[model samples]
Structure formats: structure tokens, C-alpha cells
Target: MGRKWHGQFEGEVVTDHAEYPLRGRLPGCRIKHRMKRNWLKMYDKAGWILRVETVINDPEEFRVRRRVRRRGRRRTEWVPLRKSVAYLFRYRDVSLQSNAQYLNALAQVEDPTAGLRGLDTITTRKRSTKALNPVARPDCQLFTALMSGEYAVHGFANRDLRSKLAATVVRLNDDPRRQSAQVSRLLHRLHVYGLVAKIPRSRRWRVTAFGQRIMSTSVKLRQWQFPANWPSCMTPSKLVRKNRRPNEGRSYAPFSGGPSTSPLRLVTPAIACATNSKLL
Candidate 1:
């Protein structure tokens, strides 16, 4: 009997023998051998003729072929499956908590907001009942200029404010002399919005605490883009009671009366007559 050889290819076992393929015959081809020890015959499912035949050769020297169907026609071709370099170097999968811990540790290596300051106190105007949030476009621009310290000092004129914001924003016209009208409109809107106040009869304006909050927070948001993962050092300032002192410019007195011990009373407005109206 010829020497029998056994080996594996891509986890599949194969067998071969010596002197398997005769001259002018392919490897693994079935043929009547002189020793008759290297022939294998497999009958077809219909059992009419032999379909699969193998001749013993080198087990590791086998070729693989696949049947591919295209346009309703079938064809046989050789296709080899092999491992890639990236697959050999890939790392094992990690757990969710492990990944999160790694990211948390990586974040602690540096602080992005170490020197940044928190937002200032935000309060609505004393006599104004409108919500102070969502500042308007012109108001936001004017407030940013006012809070930049230079314009905030000694209060700034419409021209000086325009000069400060000229290169940064495009709201002002190209002609410096013609910017007064636009600047005055923005100042009037800011006053109406209650974000800043004018000193009795002066051309200058001062930003309120509410305006500081709105402008600074808006600028910070625009600059930082409100990243998905907020840094650890971006903590806000600690809050204190504005009414702690009795002489502070508090709008209303704190409710010292205990929780209501009786049912609440409701007030209703009386309808007015059209004939008694002052502006009909």
C-alpha cells in the first residue's frame, strides 16, 4: 500500500496518497492504478455512474472549488479562504463599564475649563414682568460689546460701541458716519428689552445683571459649542439668597407667614363698560 498522508486545511481534514495522478492526469483524479491502493469511487445519488473520485496524494496540497450561480447558470471555480493580518492583530471585545472607566480616566488627564469662570447671577427686571431668557439678536450683540469691560467702563457712546464691535460683527454699515442710526436703534431695543439701562439723560448705557448672564452665557455657548461631554471643571458658582440682607434692592419681601392654615382666596376682575373707557 502507498504511504497514506493526513492533514488539515482551513480546519477541514484531507487525505492523499503517493503515485496518485498518472501522467497527463490532474491531482486527486481517479484512475486505475497499478497497485490499486490509491483509487476512491463514489456513486452519484442516482446510482447510475460514479460522481466523486479521489486519488491519494499529498493531503496538504489540495485545491478548493466553489459552484457560483449567475444569470440562472452555474459555474465551478477555485476560491481560497485565508486569514488576514488585521484579523490576527485584533483585540478582544471589552465590556461597557470597562470602556467607560477607561474614558473617565483619560478625561482626568487634563482640564479644559480650568481657568474659565462660571456664569453670573440672572434676574428679571424689577418692574418688568417679561421673561428675561431668549435674548433678541440686536440685544445679544449690543450686550456682548457692553460686557467686554472696555465699553462697560464709564459707559460707552453709540460711536464708541460701534468702533468696538466694528471688526467683529457685520451689523454695522461700512460707512462709520452712517452707523449712528443702526447703533441708536439697537440701544433703544436693548432698553425696551430691559437688558440695559441709560443713565437718566446720558448717551451711555450700563448692562444689568440679567444682561451679563445672557450675553456671557450666549458667548460661551457660541464659543464652546456646548460639547456632548461637559468637562469636570465647568462647575457653576454656588448660589446664595439675594434676600439675605434686609436693605438689599430686593423686589419683594420674603414670605415670613407660615404655610396657609385656611383655604386660599381668589380675586376676580370686574368687567369695564365701553362708554366709560378713556381711549375709545
Candidate 2:
């Protein structure tokens, strides 16, 4: 629920994976969104009660504006969610409102894309539309560049990505304005695809949770099994041992279950038969 917020968010509030440990990793909300010090935490109690609580570690986070005198000049000052019995009602109201918003948004979600179906939108190319096609050599390069580890923190700006994108897709015009414009278009496409989102009140973008997963997988697809590098392919388990240019034609053989009740099975033996020889 906390992850639904379009602001600076990190981990999912309602994930089985625990980012924050409280007496070991518990399956519940332990997100530290609003601020590092102040956050809203909700978890199950006794496997029944839904304990939703907000903690304002730093009172200054919730500011109260007031006029204060400073050197005979009246200047406005701010004061700061939960830490006093006197304002318990205020805290409860705020917490309940946030809970309502989270639940409301979650309720309205109709058939959210939680499957791999969305991958088609990124890798499929249509000449008539300006959609991204990561399957292409150039587009795949551009797609991987956006997932650079450095930009994970504080997001990235046009200047930060422009040079990277230009380096990969050198076909783009040499003009800086053109490069910047191209990068802008790429970012727009990423935003449209939900792979990235613009930081509020800033000209920067951060990869969302979904973006991290989908982009990483998409990038790996560029190197998926093709020319004898199947070990590191996306489906690593599907190994191939076929007779190729150098290997003898007898690549696989059926194991004989002579006199035994065990069922015979076909297996690829490491040792290949010599040319023009037949196994007995």
C-alpha cells in the first residue's frame, strides 16, 4: 500500500520480504517512507488484529508554522506525527486518513498487471508507433544503460542519462540539444511504460519496483542463449548438448536396461562416438 504512493518510496509496505527487522524478519508493513526517522508501520497482531501505527521519530517532520521574532523581525517558523498524549486525537486522525487513502486506492485497482504480459509492450516493435523495443540491438543497449547502479540513489536527470544513451546509440545527431531531446523522449517512453517515474518537484527520475524487475530481466534477454552461451541464459536449466559443427553426430544415446526392470531413458553422454562408428 505504501508503495502505491508516487512520491519517494522504497520497499513495499505489504511484502513478505522484510527490509526492516523487528525481532527477526516478520511479514508485515515495515516501510520507512515519509522519512528515515519518521514513518508509518502496520502489521498483524495475534494473527487477527490489524495494527496500524505511525511513528514520528523526528517531531520536526510535522511542522507547525508560526510567526517568530528574530532580531526585531517577525519570521514564520514551523513546528512538527506521534509523540504526545496531548495530541493523540490529531495523530489518530492523520493515521486513519492515510490508512483510508491506501485502502481506497488498493480497492479501486482492477486487474493490475502483476504478470509477464507487460513485457510485450517493451520488446514488441511497431513501425507506426513510437514504442520502445528493447529486443532490438540499439534499443537493448539504451534499455540497459538506464539501469546503471549509480543512478539508483537520488534518481537521475537528463544530463546524467543523455551522455550514456548517446554513447550507445551513436546514430543520434551529434548536436547536444538533439542528444538532450532524444534522452527526453526516451525518458518519456520509460515514464509512459511505468518503468520510471518523475520525482515530485524535480527534473529527475527514479526506477520503480516494477521497473527494476522488468528492466533487469529485459536486459538479460539481450544475452539469452543463442551462440553457445546457454549456461547464463534466462532459463539456465534448459541445457543443450546437440551434435554441432565439431561434435560427432551421435550426441545422445539410450541407456540399456538389460535384465533390469528399470525403464530405459535417453541421455547425452559426455564422450561422443567416433566418425562412422555405431554403438552396440
Q: Which candidate is the best by lDDT?
A: 2
Tell me the tens digit of each residue's lDDT in model 2 across 156-234: 9999887676667536667889878878887887777778999999999998887887777767776664333644554
Residue range with the least summed lDDT across 10 consecutive positions in model 2: 234-243
Query: Deviation in angstroms for 175 in model 1?
Result: 3.7
lDDT by candidate, in order shown: 0.49, 0.63
| Candidate 2 segments exceeding 4 Å error | 1-114, 123-129, 224-280
Model 1's number of clashes is: 3
Model 1 weakest 10-residue run by lDDT: 87-96
Give candidate 2's total backbone clashes. 3
lDDT of 1 by residue, 164-243 (tens): 77766447887766788877766676666556788768877888766676678766664464553355444332122332
Cα lDDT over the full model 1: 0.49
TM-score of each: 0.32, 0.39
